[model samples]
Target chain A: LAKTTQPISMDSYEGQEVNITCSHNNIATNDYITWYQQFPSQGPRFIIQGYKTKVTNEVASLFIPADRKSSTLSLPRVSLSDTAVYYCLVGETSSGGSYIPTFGRGTSLIVHP
Target chain B: DTAVSQTPKYLVTQMGNDKSIKCEQNLGHDTMYWYKQDSKKFLKIMFSYNNKELIINETVPNRFSPKSPDKAHLNLHINSLELGDSAVYFCASSPPTSGNTIYFGEGSWLTVV
Candidate 1:
């Protein structure tokens, strides 16, 4: 398990791009970084995940540097509905083929009008 | 058709009482997890079960017991609930491999009165 550090909160306006960075200095060789988004009364939804370099999905893009010590989650053209808490997790596959990701305090992104 | 669902969306119980939150995932995932989100909104992994076997158990108290009857069902039972136990409990499931996306259920809000 790797510990991750991220900003406590961020502010973004609608139609703007929002980027939240996470630092995982002790990331393992086999670890993968994943980002999740949680709304007020709903469960956290998977946004994007990447092992290295970059990976993009319909919702967001994840950028991991070559060193793998940090990663960034980019959400484009944000809307008020995108205002939520974002979590970054780093975990590796265990022998049983299961990964128990550790969650941090997460970054609260407020998308304003 | 929600992939993951938990019963009793909100539970209001008294101290020393016992309560249970049932969860089922129809995503055909092999691993299920229980996570706790405190009032301060810090999410922590409580337990993880893979194919009905306990895979990860954090330092949570014994009063919080998790039972996985099968690959698709995991239930949490809390005994002698205390005020400190008031928080949102989320049920989630993921594939057996690492770096896969995990689906979460709408949390079960437990209020210990």
Candidate 2:
């Protein structure tokens, strides 16, 4: 399992774009990066994921560089409801997977309306 | 309807007691996981079960036992709970492959008094 590091906290105003970057200096060859969002008293929700380049969905966009050493999660037009802690995970999801994912201290994004 | 659901969203119990948290996923996924979020908001993987078989078990205490009766249900039974067991327990499920989205439940807040 690859270790990930991210900002402890971030602040953004409503309608603004927020980007949280995660650094995994020792990412494995088969490792895929995933991002999750969690509101207070709720479970984490999948935001976006990418191996390399850019992957966009209806919720967020993930950008990965050629080296795959880091990834960015971009949330567009943020609202107060988007204020939550976001986690960055790197691992392989499989039926016979061995190593478990280590979720370090996540980035808390405070979106003020 | 919620795809991943856990019973007893909030559990307040005394130390040395035993309790169980039940999780059910309607998403038809083959892999399920239990994660614990500490007071500092660091999420850690406790266990992962796929097709009723244990695939990943982290360095969690033996007091924390995971039982999966079938593909859709996974229950966590904690024996002799201690104050350190107080945290948010989240149940999640994913497909058998990586890069796919993992759905999470609302979470069960366990308060050990």
Candidate 3:
């Protein structure tokens, strides 16, 4: 399992775009980078993921460079409701043999209005 | 419909007691996981089960046991719970073949006094 490092917290005003980055120096060849968002008193929700280059979804975008040692999660047009903790994970497997792996402390994004 | 759901959103119990948190997923996925979030907000993987078989078992205490009776349900039973067990427990599910996206249940806040 690769260990990930990210900011503990960040703050931004509503309607602004926020970019949070994660560092995984020991990422494995089969490791994929994923991001998750969590609100207070709630579980972490899936955001976006990528192996290399970039991947985007309705919620967020994930960017992984060639080295795959780092990734960035971009939340466009933030809102106060977007204030939550964001986690960046690098793993070889998830639930089952699918996309499950290990997750680390995510960045806390405080979207202000 | 809720993709993933957990029971007893909040649990307050005394130490040395036994308690359980139930999780279910309606996404028809084959894998489920249990995670613990400490007060400082660090999320760690405790266990992962796929098709009722244990896959990844972190170095968690033996007091924490995860049982998956079927494909969609994964229940966590903590025996002789301790004060250190007080934290937010999250249940997540994902298709065994999914590339990145994983669904998460709301969470169960367990407070041991």
What TM value does model 2 have? Answer: 0.93
lDDT of 3 by residue, A1-113 (tens): 46889988999999999999999988878767778888887878777878899999898888888888888898899988899999887775533454446677778788776
Fold similarity of candidate 1's chain A to the true chain A, as a TM-score: 0.90
Q: How would you encode candidate 2's per-residue C-alpha lDDT over B1-113 as one tens digit per residue?
A: 99999999999999999999999999999999999998889988899998999998877899999999999999999999999999999999999666678899999999999
- Candidate closer to the true structure by DockQ (higher is better), 1 or 2: 1
In terms of TM-score, which candidate is stronger, 1 or 2? 1
Best by lDDT: 1
The TM-score between candidate 3 and the true structure equals 0.91
- Residue A45's lDDT within candidate 1 is 89
Ranking of all predicted structures according to TM-score, beginning with the best and ending with the worst: 1, 2, 3
lDDT of 3 by residue, B1-113 (tens): 88999998999999999999999999888889898889989988888888998888877899988999898899999999999999999999887653557788999999999
**Model 1 chain B: lowest-lDDT 10 consecutive positions:** B94-103
| C-alpha TM-score for every candidate | 0.95, 0.93, 0.91
Ten-residue region with minimum lDDT total, candidate 3 chain B: B94-103
